[model samples]
Target chain A: MSAADLSRCSLNSATVKHASLTELVDAAAAAGLGAVGLWRHQVQEAGAEQAARAVAGAGLRVSSLCRGGFLTAADEAGIAAALEDNRRAIVEAATVGTRELIFVVGGLPAVSAPGQGPRPDAGPGDRDLVAARARVADRIADLVPFAAEHGVRIVLEALHPMFAADRAVISTLGQALDLAEPFPAETVGVVVDTYHVWWDPQLREQIARAGREGRLASYQICDWILPLAAEPLNSRGHVGDGYVDFAAISAWVSGAGYTGDVETEIFNEEIWADEPVATARTVGERYARYVRPYL
Target chain B: MSAADLSRCSLNSATVKHASLTELVDAAAAAGLGAVGLWRHQVQEAGAEQAARAVAGAGLRVSSLCRGGFLTAADEAGIAAALEDNRRAIVEAATVGTRELIFVVGGLPAVSAPGQGPRPDAGPGDRDLVAARARVADRIADLVPFAAEHGVRIVLEALHPMFAADRAVISTLGQALDLAEPFPAETVGVVVDTYHVWWDPQLREQIARAGREGRLASYQICDWILPLAAEPLNSRGHVGDGYVDFAAISAWVSGAGYTGDVETEIFNEEIWADEPVATARTVGERYARYVRPYL
Candidate 1:
């Protein structure tokens, strides 16, 4: 596994979130990586136009934009606001020169305002997950023309079920593909992130279906760490540190004919503490050894 | 929502883990509850035969046995040991006189023995979840004959996906039902515990399927609490306390024609801190308010 084998490797800016967009782009290019996946906040910090110019100047491809969806609001005002925000995200993705804009599709609406703690009046009867998910589907359909017009694809990422309530109601690749089915494959696709979907029983079949339908938008890699952190969001491990079968899953993705950027997107606090350049080098090496062979 | 409507309520002993088998039986009976679910250790402390006698003497039914399967071992000896333990559990379930013996089928075998922190040499490539799941299927087939002879149904309970690596690989009702399909539904079944499975997107369809197949062995109820505990196992909330929609899910189960015991099987430190009798009464009231109408 040499630097030459890392030609398809992409550094997701969130993996080294401490780094500025400029620093991530520079580190990724210096490490001989072919692409970089940018987060919305990081791109905004560098200014989307400047971020695009920097990546292009560094001779690196913009693999994808971090995210753009939170359409599960209980009220009309909230729904309208979410759609407006997503339309802006589509424009941002277009500005950053990436066709793939991942959408996490938010979870159930909050019963009360933030920091109110658990609602004392709340009961088991208040949540309607099915309705929340339906709203996500409808909102995605609404955003399809906007995204397509901007030449950006809406990549629906299925978060692990642990985040089903507060992060993403779409918890499996099959479900994401199901939601994406009504739209054009190029305009709406699904993300095959190993961190979220590795435990899925229907992973192989779903990946195959996504490939068959030309809906395999982006292939992201990360590990599932044990003793999950207090903030479960930061529990993702470096590629070789946890229990995901990356080689097998990567082979499935590669076999499905996905020839796109392979992003190493981790969210561990420990990994975030490392120097950006060193983290990029380490991730690149791991990707070469663990994932490149399969590809 | 009167005591008459509570005729199907059962106190799962784990919901009050501090209580002895005798105390559980007596409290459940005194509360006018119809049944009590027993755990093996609690029954052993009271002596299984004596425990059976006491429950009968108290005129209470044994709703189900707490557990019986951990067949995800990699080595032959480990696999044999697990099967042997499950055999004993089958006998214990029969002794306690309950047809439903719920199995929280264990997760992937540890790379090394206990107390060795995450295996340094282990990687995602080392764990074979597909093979581990296949072993669970094979072991369940091996135990079906014994369970049949004892007239005890082997109930496979899908633990939450967060427990996929260390607790139970059977992480969805659909997967559990798929595993149980090769065997007789009467000899092998699936436990639909709300805490473990409420996040599943295909939950309603799977519950309906479980009913149509007559394999809905146990209907356990508990809430999915927020800010999950440091140890996820203790995160189960009392019925009205968390985000689970009991009325909706229970309606689905009831609509499927399930008339079994509704076991309130919670595992929270806060709930366990209460007096056993008080806890039983509170749970009964909550069940009457939140779940009884649907049933």
Candidate 2:
């Protein structure tokens, strides 16, 4: 087994969120990396068309567009608004020259005021998770044509079940595939993020099934930390910093015929504080050590 | 659709951790509840024989034993020690006259030192969750015969996936049933705890399967609260106080022919601060209002 080549390494912008779109692009090229994953917020900050021109101008490939799905809204008006925003996201992904538009299908819609973040002390309401999930499926179906016409794919990312309440209702790759089964694989596929699916008992079988069905849209990597951050949303660790078995998981991912860019996507506050260039270098080195060998 | 009969209500001692075994038994009987679930710690505190006598004398049935399985140790010594501890728990349950010995099967063995709890800053070690799960299956097989001989059933409890690292590896009812399938239903069964299994996408199907197999050993209820406490283990709320839809879930339990005791097993700091008698009365009222009608 030789060392994993840097050709497949792509730095997700969220990994070094402090970096501007230009800084992320220049950093990846400066670090001798092959590609970069862009987030919509950062892209929107630079104007989507301008961000796409900058990446293309630098000769860097956009591995994926950060997000486009929050289809589970509390009301009919909210659902219509989400669909309108997602349509714009499809056009943005196409402009950025990335077919993969990752969808973090949202959880149960909040009943609170629009600007107020999730109230920690709020009691549970009549949020039907199953119904929220059904809305996601229907909304995705509604968007598939627009996404396909724009030469983009709807990439469904199943977050860890802990986030099932406020982040994403799709808690497993199997569930994601089940939702995607009725649609064309190229139009609606699933994201296999190790950070989310590593704890799953049926991971290997489901990853294999995802591959067999041609629904493996993306492969994101990050480690799972313990005594999770005060807000677990930022608990993702740098590669090799937490408890995920990268070697084993990567072997399964590679075995499933996935030859796409392996994006390092950490969301830790501690990692976000480090210098972007230094973090990218460290992430590359760790990926080579922990994940590359198996690949 | 009249009010649910209180004849089947059981107060799990942990729900009122501040209460002594005698107090719990007396409170449940005084509340006109038909049964009480005992934890080994409480039973050991009162002496199993004494606890048994107190419950019997109070005319209350021992609904089920709190737990007995932490079988996923990393070393032979740890495995042997866990087996010995579980063996004692079995005898304790039998001595207290309960046929169901509930098992909260332990998670990946810790590499940390004795008395040192899970380190928030610890790096990922070589803990293989799959292998640890295999060890749990093997250990449970080793304990099944002893459990059968003693006229007690090994009840597998699938905890929420958040506890997969330091607590329990069985993260879903489906996974628990898979582990229990190799053994006889009479000797091995699965617990249906709303707090643990409520997030599951396959809840209805799995609960039905457990019923069809005659393996629904215990049906415990508690609400899932949000802004989970710093230590998530104590985040359980009283019924109707959190997100779980008790009417929907309890109907499934009842349709499956689960005529056993409905144990209210809450573990919240707020709930624990209340007087035991008052807590019991509140729980009974909530159970009747939220879950009993469905059952």
Candidate 3:
């Protein structure tokens, strides 16, 4: 019942997206949160140095950097540019004193990195899947040395099915782990987000698999929306707000010897438009009631 | 290909929903289709007795009955009624000489049997996926004996995430198999509809597993529309229209040892508004292009 026990809790800045980087950090500290998670765009907008100073000043931990993915591009040059952008992201994470940079592997070549110029088109066939998957592994290999140099970990987050064509070829924890196998464990890890993975029957087994391999980088929670609309990426809800078994997952993470922070990361329009403090407070209280039972 | 070999293609009556049950059967036969799938309401409207005669008269095989699920009602009476209704459905399938009786397990009690009667309400916080699962198994247990007697198989269809709450508790092929294990394999089975299951990473493995277990009952195909509306059930597209790897699935089905008919079961507004012959020809041609590779 103690607020400090909220040590397990981390305020992913995406949850209180309306708040500026400084305001978000202050809100987390004021709410007695033990850690915070930041997004790269917000970090860039706030100035990485200023954001880092504010986070350290609040005596807060940066659980994870929002992301460094969408690597799929039309050509080799575009892919090279994506690798450079990811390296910069790793540097930004290092500046913020965080080691894990979450990766949402890009979807389709066009959608994942739209700014990249047009390239060859592949039909919707196994050959396309095989090529996309190979491209993902190759890019990860390219980024590994840069990630290693920064003492940073690359945590690939597998998205839901809708994004498979355009997003990550590695679309499940198992698939991500398979891609991570060739890389050093420390250099490549996985972020277990409830929103993307709760529907998986292999949830418990995969979490255990990640832990056993020492690949557990971040534990994130959101909700799974039903009757989903066109755009699958931005439809996430709050923990316990949808049909996912948050308590079961919380229990699984605890059992897996994962003592890291549990970050709340919702991408809903309704929640994002509300007051940031109100959002944080509601998230805090809900996590306590819905997730604490497992603890 | 010979028309008889081409005849193996079946029109899942849902493809030409605007056509009456008799017209669908007549069209399939005239087009030299080997089989057709029929829904209960369509049968009810056309009269199951008359529909059966028409299917037989056209020298058509009833590949599968459209559905007989939503067994997860709120009370004992509701449960009993569902069981009784399933028994009648088995008789109807037998009358039509169809081997498979497809079940779309009902969603949340309220949504499952809308306004049928008052029912017990389930909460969002309630994580009793176990109880819902048990109810599905229990209902199946009641119907297995009747299904066995009728020489008909009960195939539970895996629904999408949107229907997980109220429709079918068995939302995945693996989960559906788990629900089916207690029953005799000949009497209990699973229907693999690409629209419902194409997104599953475990699809190939599960389909292989179902084949090994000899529990794969039927294969249905429909397109999964991208940027789908909020509703999950109503947004299916025609065979070649969406992003699914239909050829790959056909390959999996063939590799998994299913020599049964592959039915096209589309429920799109555009196809529904088209002429029945146009819809049938479109489905047949699309199957030839996107799905015939495996066959």
Candidate 4:
């Protein structure tokens, strides 16, 4: 497939970990891909301005920024630090020329995340999910003005419920939208990631509702694989390698009137071990075969 | 706390895997737990009639049965076998003196579950979650008459979304309620298992809804522990050990007017390794400190 054939598909930077922002940009441009999605860490490592320049130099679009939300902090200092980091993230996202800054809104307090241990600075243990969720809202409200001023949409990504205990409080597109609805569409949005949400019963209606609300900031694709016990964070597969029905999901995205770039943000260890350019090419090929046709 | 304090705390048989039904019943009665929940496998191993006799002999009430639903079959033979097995499960539940028979509706097709391999009898492969869920509803419908005839309520247990692929497709208390509402309250009901549902955003409302509709069949508890990657099926901890705010959750269950036995269905390896009587005593102690107060 030509670059035009891969027009709507975007390779998320985390998918190819060894590559710097410049290398990812060049590889995406050379691999017949039209755009690349960047992670905040990668852009910061290369310096956001330099990363922006690299993408511009390669004539490729920056689809969206990888992440910018752990706003479930309960302590005052932790909350202050989280807001500061998010403000910096918004500035970096603006520098990278992507309006969407994804937020993995944090999970239940004190619970340890896989590999990444407990947040050292969280308040005296909070297990009240309701209170933690309310805190997430208040913190987002604090950041909305800064995000809007920087021309960035705070995009909420509802991870699979496995992460609900320690990674993300927002565990469904519906919940993400509930949080998003309180803010303007340009200031707050939600991501439709297939791997994270393929199991949700309300996904289709929620996708349409997201588009209708003009909060569909990003459309992401990745297959939900087997041997799920391997590791929650790295169990994703190529589009057709798992149980996700990409055709039906892509059609839902298209029906939602979302013409935005469909990004692949897989976290599998095996895919990360492969060559960057080859992985990018395979991502596009899988998108064309399993997703694009339905869209 | 005395045995009277543990009036509502029921120890699920899965927590004491090595013990035979007679031993478990004797231990529960000795441990001052008013009831002991039985699993179909244990009941079958001891003979359902013999299990019922042991429970009666020990003056211990049988709480809900462990499970009887993997009814996501797409083929005729598979569907027929599931119904047959469920009928036997109903008979076993009746024989064991429990009105409730729990169902863990199976997950997406061909995926390998933790420890348990893929079901060789499952159809070619069903990836459409919507279709699989619809199939679950259909199979449950097929089981209702038999269950009702046997004076058993077909109970649905919503697993955490982590198990949405290979263990259980029903992933929320609300989804379970939705499935349960279609049948008469006596014919179909839902379980409120804290470990599987503590993360849901709509849990409080759904709990109330389940109460209002008279579809709340079972109340089970087990702490949602840390180091979640240990194993999905065996990661449960003792009450108050993990991030579950049992006080608040028990308050909700009480507010919903649930007067039934609050069972503990923990599956932790460490807990199972302990002597059965000791484990039951610890379970009661934890329930008294963390859960009984709220109730």
Best by TM-score: 1
Which residue pairs clash within candidate 4?
A: none
List candidate 1 stretches off by more than 4 Å. Answer: A111-118, A121-126, B111-117, B121-126
Ranking by TM-score: 1, 4, 2, 3
lDDT of 3 by residue, A4-47 (tens): 76777889998887889888988888777888999999889988
Candidate 2's residue-wise lDDT over A169-217, tens digit each?
8988999999999999999989999888887888899999999999898
Q: Write the per-residue lDDT of candidate 3 for residues B160-244, one digit (tens) a residue.
A: 6445655666667888888888888999999898887776667889999999999999989987655564454567887765557
Clashes of 2: 0
Better of 1 and 3 by lDDT: 1
True contacts kept of 1: 0.34
Q: Model 4 chain A: which ten-residue window has the lowest total lDDT?
A: A115-124
| lDDT tens readout by residue for model 2, B112-218 | 53223445554344457788789999999999999998999999999988778777889889999999999999999999999998878788889999999999999
**All models, RMSD in angstroms:** 1.8, 2.8, 3.4, 2.2
When only the first chain is scored, the TM-scores of the models are 0.96, 0.93, 0.92, 0.95
Ranking by lDDT: 1, 4, 2, 3
Clashing pairs in 1: none
TM-score-superior candidate, 3 or 4: 4
Q: For candidate 4, lDDT tens digit of each residue in B24-98?
A: 887788788889899988989889988888888887788899789998877799899989988899999998899
DockQ of 1: 0.50
